[model samples]
Each structure stands twice: as structure tokens, then as C-alpha cells.
Target: MSALTMPLAVRVIRAEHDALAAMLRTLPLLLAAQRLALVPPDFGALRAMLFYVDEFPERLHHKKESELLFPKLRALVPGLRGTLDDLEMDHAQGERAIRELQHSLLAWEQMGESRRDKFEQQLRVYSTRYLRHMKREETEILPHAVRHFSADDWAELDEAFGGHQDPLAPRAGQAVDEAYAPLRQRILAELPAPFGWGPALGA
Candidate 1:
């Protein structure tokens, strides 16, 4: 096949898709340090970071695809039947993970060091497991989607997501530069040397 021309939705989705993975890799380390190490975490900063990583980027960006992209794909490829069901279930599973970890986020953020340690352990395990789920969607599912979705389909999907409020928007003026600055730089640097839409993005 000729070089894949990513519609704007694909382009933005791919960025978010990889960005969430990159954040997942670092979050465990952040929690690990919060526990065994003596440094005190700024709950505000950590919460801000997670807001973007967990909610804004992944839940918002990827979920929009399920709401928007899958319907178009199903129209194009009847063989893709049940794909949306599986994708929706996967998203629910991810939300379940978030629900389970919700208390831990509060504990780590609100309580003192003692509670932080306990919360850290639980959060790390949950994050590591969640990363595996993300990998399945990115590799097994997203590439197959790119293969069949047309430029017009992608354009409509892009418009759909554009209207949705970004979950991280509330923190953009404050937490973005202070809390997530390092992470944003780290992700751009750590992306796989050969990365892009289609096969180049870890297909």
C-alpha cells in the first residue's frame, strides 16, 4: 500500500494514543517514588498530572473514537461486526480500573506519607495492568481501523471529537506548565524511533 494519508482525526488520535502510553510508563515510577522515597508529593500537581494522562488524553480522546470512528468503520466493513462491542467493553473495563483506583488517588493525595505508601502500591499495580489493555487496543485494534476507514470518515470523526470538551482543559492554565511539563517533553523524546500512522506507529 502507498503511504497512508492520515485524516486529521487519525493524526490527533495517534498523538493521544501514544501520549497516554508514554504517561502510563512514567506514572508507576512517580508513585513508586512517592512511597519508598522521602520526598513529599504535591497532591495538586499529581492530581493535575493524572487528570491529563488518565482522563483528558486517554478517556476523552480514545473514547471519542468509539463514539465516532467505529460507526463509520462498521459502515465500511461489515466484517468488522462486533468490533464496537469489544471496543466499548474495553473502555468500560478501563473505566472500572479507574473506579477501583479512585480511592487510592484520594488517599495518595489527601493523606500523609503513611497513606501515600499504601495508595502508591495499589495505584502502581493498577496502572501497569491498564497499560497492557491500552497496548491491545493500540496494536490489535487501531491499525486494523486505519486500514479500512476512508479520509471522509476520518474527517467526520475529527469534527465529532473537536466539539467535546477536553477533560484537561480546566488545568491547562495552571497545572499544564508546572505539573505536566516534564512529562510532555519526555513523551516526545521517548516515542519509538520509528513512529507514525499505520504500521510505523507500532503496528
Candidate 2:
């Protein structure tokens, strides 16, 4: 669908998904480069990126999907219950997963090189799962929503999804909120060109 014709909630969700996917793709590269250089991992930047995932996508984006979008879709489609259930399960597990990642990150930071492999492995698993989860939503779930949802449904979903801007992926012309400016900056600064808005890594 054209940008002007698409539902606001759909637009927001896709943009958020794109932003998140970029960050997920960047994490391993960032870690690998640091390791190759024999430089210390920038724990603060890594934390900020992960925290953004937790704070924005996990807390805000997925909550709206679970509470508003998924339930509504389930009611309308009925046939999609299985898929929706799986997505919801992913949502439920997301918090615990992020917390575990954070804990692994801390362990790696505190225990030195021996712990690095564990955190990297966990990150890989988490990223792959999340990427697949989003792919299902976009391909399986969202298309059904587009077909089934009424204008009223879009109205409600738009209100909920559009209420808050993602700090890392603000809409065009929307400035990053001050509260998240530092976190956003840290992430951009850490990630290289194409992956982030900031300068290239090592530049």
C-alpha cells in the first residue's frame, strides 16, 4: 500500500520493526570488531542498545500488539489463533529473555574474556528468535489484519500505536525525545554507518 493510504499503526509498526532489525543486525558486528581490535567492549553502548529494545519494542510496541492488535485479529480471523498464540507467547517470554541478556552482559563485563562467548551466544539466539518473530508478524499476521480490520479497528490501533514515538526510530521530522536522547546517541555513536545514524565505526 502507498504511504498516504496505509494505516498509521501499520506504518509505525513497520518503521519500528526496521529500526529494531537494524540494531539487532549491528550487535554482533560491533562485538566482533571490538574483539578483533583487542579493544574493550563498550558495555555502556551495548547496554543502551539492549535497553532500547527492552524499553521501546518490548514494552511499548509489543504491548500494543498483544493487547490491541493480536486480540482484535484473533477475534476477526479465528483461524489465526494458533499463529497469534505463538506471537503472544513470544511477547510473554520477551521480558525474561531481555533480562537474561542483560544479566549475561553484566557477567561478561565483570568476568572478562572467558564470559564473552556466553553473552555472544545468547545474543545470537535472542536476535534470531526476535527476527523470526517479527517476520511472522509482518508476513502472517499483519496481512490478515490489513484484510480484516475495520476502520474502527484501525482508529483504535492507530491511537494506541501512534501515541508514543520510538526514540530510536522517530518518524520523519520528529525529534528524539529528550529523555531518550542520551540512549539514542550512545547507540548511534557505537554502531557504524548504515547501521546507525551516526558516523562510521572507527571513524
Candidate 3:
């Protein structure tokens, strides 16, 4: 197949989707560690990861897709309104899922053993839901956007998506984004060499 000449927004969204999917895949490992009582779950690392999810994707990525990209795509593509609406609804549901997962994590951390199972269950559910949502957008919505959205539309969308700072999740003053900076360092320090943050393999 020929390579797609995709909009900048499409490329950025796809990269973010892959990264978040990797995090979702790692959650089960964390849960297993907690259950086996082997290498204890790094609650701090997990918390940082979850916070990053909330701040970046749930806050910034999905909002831009729903409010800006999706609307434009629906207008340009015939018979896309239903699919676009479904994706928008998924974004709303995903946000609620994240909030619930956050509460469960806090309870697990503070209340301890009693909340373990509940936290794990919520985490798994949220991961599954989010992964499914992202996959649908990747397979269905992104293709439609790439095919139908005008160059001018892509240009504007690309510029908005390519902002240096997250449009929705900015930090206080000149400080780094709370959810990303420390979390990234924590991931690098806490995770093993392969899993830790840093340059990708053979980079």
C-alpha cells in the first residue's frame, strides 16, 4: 500500500495512541506484581503514569479530537455523523472512567488491602475501554480524516495539535507540567532498563 500523506494531527494522535496503549499493556504487569507479592507495585510510578494519562490524552488529546477534528471531519465526510458522535461519546465515557480509576487508586493507596481488588478491577476496565476507543479512532476516524479533510483544514488542525505546550493541560507559571515532568523521571528511575523512560531501543 502507498504511504499515507497524513495531516500532522493524524501523526501526533497516532503516536500518542501507541504510547498510551503501551502504558495500558503495562498495567496488567503492575497488577500481577501486586498480586504475587514479588516486586511490589510502584504505586508512585503507577500514579504518575495515570496522572499523565489524565492530563495529556483525556484532557488535551481527546478534547481537540472531539471539539475540533471530529467536527470538521464529520462535515467533510458524508455519513460520518454517527461514527463521529459515537467517538465523541466514547471520549466522555473515557473521562468518567479515568476519574473513577483515580478515586479507586487513591482508596487503594490510603485504605490499603481492602481496596486492592477494587483498584485492580477498575484499572483493568479503564485500560480496556480506553484501548478500544483509541483503536476505533485509529482505524475508522483517522482514515476518514486523512481522506476527506481539506489541506486548509489539516493545516489549521495540525497547527493546533502541534502546539509546544498542551493547550488544555498547561502548568502553573513557568513550572513544568506536573503530570509529565516528574512522572517521566520517575518512570526512568523506577522501571527496569528496558521499560524505563529514555531513548528508544537503538536510538
Candidate 4:
């Protein structure tokens, strides 16, 4: 659907999801290229990226999904209760998972190459699971919402989702927060062409 015609909340959700998915996809490539080139990982950049994921997707995006969107969906379509439950559970686990990832990243950064494989493995698993989770929501949950949600429901959701613009996916004419500027640059710098405007990693 055209952006102008789409519900504001749906637009916000899709944009945030795309931004997150791009970051998630770029991270493995960044790590692998660094490994292949025998370069030390950019620990600061990695930390920034992980912090963005935790701060935006895990905290902000999922908060809206679980507290507002999913509950509304469940109430409107009781048949969706099962899927919504599973998605909510994923949201709950995501906070803990990001914490574990942050810890693993710290360990790898401090403890040398011996800890690298473990962090990489955890990141791969986390990324894969999150991608799948987003796919389910887009395909299953969002379609239902688009069909079922009333004007009032859309207004409420739009107000909540629209209030917080993701730094990685700012709305038109909106500047990213100053606090996130460096983090945003780091991500764009590492993300390869086609996936992002930045230069390819290890190029």
C-alpha cells in the first residue's frame, strides 16, 4: 500500500522492522569480513549496534507491540490469541536475550579470541530468531490488523507508535537524536552498499 494511504501505526511498525532487520543482517557480514581479513573486531561499533537493538527494537518497538497492538489484535480477533501469545512471549524473552548478548559481547571483547566464537554463535541464533519473529508478525499479525482494526484502534495505535521515532528509521523531515548520531553513523559505516548507504565492510 502507498505510504499516504497506510495507517500511521502500520507505517511506523514496518519502518522500524525494516531498520532493525537491516542492522541485524549487516552485523554478521561485518563480523565475518573482519574475521576473514584477520582484523580485530570494532568492539565499540559492535557495542553501539547492540545497544541500538536493545534500546529501540527490544524496548521501544516491542513495548508498543505487546502492550498496545497485540492486545488490541487479541481482543478483536479471539482466534489470534494463540499467535499473539507466542509473539508476546517472544517479546518478553527478547529483553533477556539482548542482555545475554550484551554480556557475551563484553566477554568476547575483554577475554580475547577464545570468547569470539561463543558471541558469534549467540548473535547468529538471535538474529535468525528475530528475523523469523518479524516475518510472522508481518505476514500473520499485521495483515489481520490491517483488515480488522477500526479507525479508533488505528488512531490509538498511531498515537503510541508515532510518539517515538526510531533513530535508525526517522520519519520524513525528522532528525535523529543527537545522542544516537554517533551510533547511527557507526552502523551506516559498517553496513555494505545496497543494504545501506555506507561503504562495504572490509572494503
Candidates in order, TM-scores: namely 0.66, 0.96, 0.83, 0.95
- Taking all chains together, the TM-score of candidate 2 against the true structure is 0.96
Show where candidate 4 strays beyond 4 Å.
Answer: 201-203
Report lDDT (CA) for all predictions: 0.58, 0.90, 0.73, 0.89
lDDT of 3 by residue, 106-201 (tens): 888889879988988888888888888899898888888777777798888988887634422232354545655666677556443245554333
* Stretches > 4 Å off in candidate 1: 1-4, 34-36, 78-83, 161-203
Off by over 4 Å in 3: 1-5, 164-179, 191-203
For 31-90, candidate 2 gives per-residue lDDT tens digits of 888888897988998889889999999999999999999988888999999999899999
Give the per-residue Cα lDDT of candidate 3 at 21: 79
Query: What TM-score should be assigned to candidate 3?
Result: 0.83
User: Which candidate has the highest TM-score of all?
Assistant: 2
TM-score: which is higher, 2 or 3?
2
What is candidate 4's local distance difference test score?
A: 0.89
Candidate 3 lDDT for residue 180: 55
Candidate 1 per-residue C-alpha lDDT over 24-115 given as tens digits, one digit per residue, 9 for 90 to 100? 66655544554465556556555555555566655776567677776666776676677567766767676666665666778755665567
Give the number of colliding residue pairs in candidate 3: 0
Q: What stretches of model 2 exceed 4 Å from their correct place?
A: 197-203
